[model samples]
Target: MAKNNRTLLLIIFLLGIFIGALDTGIVSPARTVIASQLSISSSSSVWIVTIYTLAYAVSMPIAGKFSDRYGKKKVFTLSIALFGIGSLLCGVSNYAGSFSFLLAARVIQALGGGGIMPVATAYIGESFPIEKRGSALGLVGAIYGVSTTLGPTVGSALLNLVGNSNWGVLFLINVPICIGVIITALIVKDEGIVKEPKKMDVLGSIIVTLLILALMYALTNLQFHDFKNSIASTKVWPYLLAFIILLPIFIIVERKSLDPILNLKYFTNREIALTLLISFITGAGMMGIVFVPQFGENALKLKTGSGGYLVTLMAIFSGISAPLGGRLVDKYSPKLVLSMGFASTLIGSSTLAFIVAKNPSFISLLIGLAFIGLGMGFCMGTPLNYLMQTNVDPSETASAQSTLSLIRSIGVAISPNILIGFISEAGKNISPKLMTILPKVTIPGSNTAVSMTQGGSSSISPDQLAALQNADVTTITDVLKQFSGSMIDKFSPMLKQQLQNSKLPKGVTADTLVAQWKSDYLAQIDAIRSSIENMFQSTLNEGFAKLFIGAAAIALLGLIFTLLLSRKTKPVSSN
Candidate 1:
């Protein structure tokens, strides 16, 4: 290939990666809006993201194998075409008014997007000589980091420009970009080797796909159940059973297969196995990127479009740091660079967690996100990829890259689910505290004997109050109704007596007093309702703070694994 062709190919590869990374996060900012439009709960709406990740994770290894078998140019062109079609379908689904259709379209999009990154990485790893690979791959990683960072910001901007009613524009924007990618991909020459085609691992692929699907479904759906119930209930048990049964089968099948979808041999390389595990852990830690927009909107009370600015700052820094991280890898050992990257992430996460828990300022948020971006730039760019590439034979480059991609996807897919579940349960736990904080309103007259009590009435025992405190919305509402009825009973006689004492003109009756009392009671109810809403909002903010702290802890855990990378390993150069 000529120098110009290689440059063009690199540009095209970066573009492919940019689109995939963009798609992963663009919907995050507008998630609540999408749920409202589709008349779905927030939990169910998250499936739009979860399903895409699930599909992406399942398709990556298969797509890698296809690229190896069919050639990079062919696979790359088809992936771009599929992505374009999927984007079109997503836009169509928005108009169709079916949540299921939207999820299906996302699946299609994921299938295409999944192939782009691993295949593109493999292409670069193979195309560039070993000495130049770090910098080249660093540029690719930088593009990915920038794209992921910009996704929320770009999506929010598009939502603002087109109006939130036209959120479909986010997905639609990808269509033209994909078309360009496809055109460039076709013009590029295929440099992949042609060998005797090996039989694809069809059985291994099915088992692995099913296994991942079951595990993700179980984990994501846990949001619907209480924490304890989620552990013990039959609802998630079947999926757990499926995962348990499938894992050993997958391992056994891969060991036996001549051409496995995922080669078990990679596990023998301690560095490779460790890198993959760290990739998954780091991927989970990166969930902060996805949720920061929501945290801004819900907790910090930022306007919908403004939340993305923080994400943009993070992306900008990541882009700047990525190439530098690559250069560092070239200068120093990958383990050293990786350690620095993980350390940056730990500091960033801890800073954000503290800020969220105490008082979140735009400046503080920006600074924290910048650190995270810096960490992402260093950690994701060359260090880990270099480690994996160095451990594998040249022929297994695509397979190794795909396996890494798959685990990372699994991590990303499950992170939000687990975090959201924690948030949900935390919110529930705070509800009783909110009830205890309910204001003691003076009933306005000594003549009225009614008083607000913890359990609503004297007849209600301690156990009953506890039950009411732990009850669902309907049960709580019923308890409120009973309390209101008792209050009315106490107030009615006093109201009538007061009305009787008043010297009214002709035609004024007791009914007029009753109507006035009814209006006053309704106003009181409205005031109480408003107070409850405010309390709920406060509790939610607290929940988000806890989640941020948890995320930071997870990042710190990842730092440990990152530190464990072999210090003795040296950078390989093309001689």
Candidate 2:
């Protein structure tokens, strides 16, 4: 009876991990809405998102060791409490406050919530036998999938629920759940403190934390502020230089630390090392797929709220593919399961480029996204099992697994940032096009086009207004396409010229014309979109091809790592 109850408790605590994960995607859908109403930039709210994950990245490995020393239950309880605090703070932040405050609070929230997963994994593995491990791991993955799916939906629902009460409600809602998760964690007892030669290395932890954080900041920011253009700027130089300096320090410190945050000994083992590398390699390309739907809807001229559905369609495929791959891993071989998953994504990315080359249909997204999602699900979990079985004794499965879990996490952070670097590199040649007609273009903040405020002419009849609106949509789209294509075609030269000149047009007199240009730019977006919508299928097909080409190329890297795997993989043993 006690054992069964512990299982229930651990399962409940695992839900808390998704509380943080949900926040990752939750703020994503609501970003534009929140940023607009707050009179701030989308760039501001995006930090509300990327920063949390960034903070979480630095916090995870630290959390695991703290759990090891202090006890999982204590770490678990503290994490939820902090998560609740962070959520409440976020919900209440108003127009009067600063964005920096929110980021600071998120980092604190990260410090608090980081240990929940590693600790939860630590405890659950101790409670369950090896026979039950795979299923238990699957349950955890399922929970994550459910959390990620529900994140956007919940975010959307909360936005509506509060009815412009603002994004505070999304944060506020987590408060109650965190309260509940905490109570359950407190009721659970601590278990296992197997004394080994290893000791938790505090200095090593700090070095690794700094190293990862610097690298993460460097990668995520690279696209937004490219090194190519602004290589000399402090933003690029400071972070990148710090990363370069600290990385060698981290590796050296880890070698000497009594308990290295990362166990380098594993690097000597070909199978374990290679499989983990495969995980990281394949993950590198997936970063964009997660956010592509948002870009497609918000930036690419698709209607709002449509982005989530587009993402959902792809997720549906991945969700379906993962379980099928799981079964294959169980029945056939982990090698085949992983290799096929990587291959499927490669094909899917290639197909996606073609589908998205034009402004494609929502249904097409369903097919392409499903294929990739399925492939990911099939391959994701079995790698951890390989890590668990191959490293350490049977008695140390949980510890070994938690160590690998931390590595998987570092990969997750590193991979997306790498892909962001790639995707941004792809768009380096691309440019944001004007969307609407010039004469009608209502420079956003100004009132010129009916597109901005609607019904440009007070003297015009209703029928005329309707006709104007129809024509305006097409005109806006045409201008936008031409402008965008021009931006891409001449981005390199244009940027270079702009840097050299660094001057606005003759009439413009402002510190930052870029901001004003954005408004006009957004308003003008329709001009280019009509053409895009007409050629949607072909355009998306092209986009899909480009995206897959990258995903596949990266997966082939993963495939090479898999080739380094041993001749035989261990099957799922009996429970």
Candidate 3:
């Protein structure tokens, strides 16, 4: 490969990853605005974000292997065009008020965006020389870090410009940028030249996709359960069972197929196995960091914008740390650097766990959140370096990097389900009784918990009850919830007074006992809310600490495993 050509491929590869990362986080904030405008519930609108992830997660490995059979340029250009089309479709669909159509548009975007990542990453791994692979991958990781950090703030700000209702404008904005990339891609020539005798693995692709869908669905339900709805209860099992049935079939077909969407043999390689595992763990860790905003809310009760900034803090730290870690991998061993990255995450996570309650500056939280990002940055660069060290053939670089990308996506793919499951488990331990009795509760939302109902009381005669009974739908829940809460508080005193007039159970009046019971209920309810927050907060903190610590540990493990590669070092093939 010529030097100039390699540089050009690198530019295109970076663009692809940057664009893909930008899309991943951009939808999170404005999704709520989009939901109401389209007359759909938030749950339905969630797909607008989820479909992108699912598409990317399932399609990456397939796209990676596809680059080998068809030329890399062809696959890369097609991916860009598809993503651009998806983006264009989003802008046009807003006119029809069709959420389903909008969803389909999202799917198209996902399909395109999903294909872009692996191919782009693969292009980097293959085009960059062996010695410079770590730095090359680090550069890609850095761009991703910057784009991700900028996602929410950028997306929200953009929405403001387009009238928040113009959410489609975000998608439409991609078209021109994508067109530029595609035109550039067409001018670029294919870099990874191999004999064209290999066949595509059609059945393996189908099965792997099915398996990913099943896993993604099962995990998503677990992470982001609908506590109010019971349908969520039965949603997980079929997918889990189907995944169980499908995985083995996928393994068998891939092992036997002339060509597989995923090459099963790669897993047999120590570095490949370890790299994929690292990617998976990092992905999970990424999800946990994403929730730092929630912690800011639940524990500290900060404002909307304030809580969301926690994630922004993390992105900033991770973005900076990723390139630094990549340099470490280049200068030192992958193991030491990866371990440090993981350690940072663990420390940050542990710190977040001890938080009980007290409003802190959003800056302090950002500082803490930055460490989580730092840890992620430290870890993400490992697989690219590791894959380069492990794979014997230059042509296999695409598969290795692509597979790592896919596995890492597993963390994301499973995040909604993972966090949902964590919340559910935590919720079960939390007595719902607290929810009914607490002074106020935060609705399902940002880091800061807000009062679900107001504390104000109306002063009106008994005649008002009849009049308020037929109030508008908007006031019904607020009135009913608040009225019920106040009535519960006031009921004991009124009932006790009435019982006194009736001459209750002699020395053991039921009304007096009832008053005590209500008092106890209030106490218990307050305790429940406090305990719930504490329990989940501690658990998540501890879990995150361990997760980061594990990332470091995994890095160490990778270091040791990398030693094994040294023992049987695969000579870098001369370009």
RMSD of candidates 1 onward, in order: 6.0, 10.9, 9.2
lDDT of each: 0.73, 0.59, 0.64
TM-score winner among the candidates?
1
lDDT of 2: 0.59
- Candidate with more favorable, higher TM-score: 2 or 3: 3
lDDT of 1 by residue, 1-575 (tens): 88888888888888898898888878877888888888999878878887887788778888888877777767777888888888888888777878999988988888998888888887776787767667777887798889888877777778889987788888899999888888887787766643346887899989988988888777656543356777566757788899999999999998888788887876766777888888888778777677666566554554435566777778888898888887777677777777777778777777766775356666776777778888888877577777777776666666678988888766776687677865666556654654464444334333443334543446555665555554332234335544544555556677668767877558876657565655565556555764554454456667677677777777777778877778755433211
Residue-by-residue lDDT tens digits, candidate 3, 152-257: 7678778878887688887788899888888887786665744264677889888988998888777666634454352345767788889999988888887787
| Candidate 2 ranges with C-alpha deviation above 4 Å | 36-39, 94-98, 193-200, 224-227, 292-302, 320-333, 355-364, 385-390, 393-532, 535-544, 567-575
Residue 128 error, candidate 3, Å: 2.3
Instruction: Please give each candidate's TM-score.
Output: 0.82, 0.74, 0.75
Q: How accurate is candidate 1 locally (lDDT)?
A: 0.73
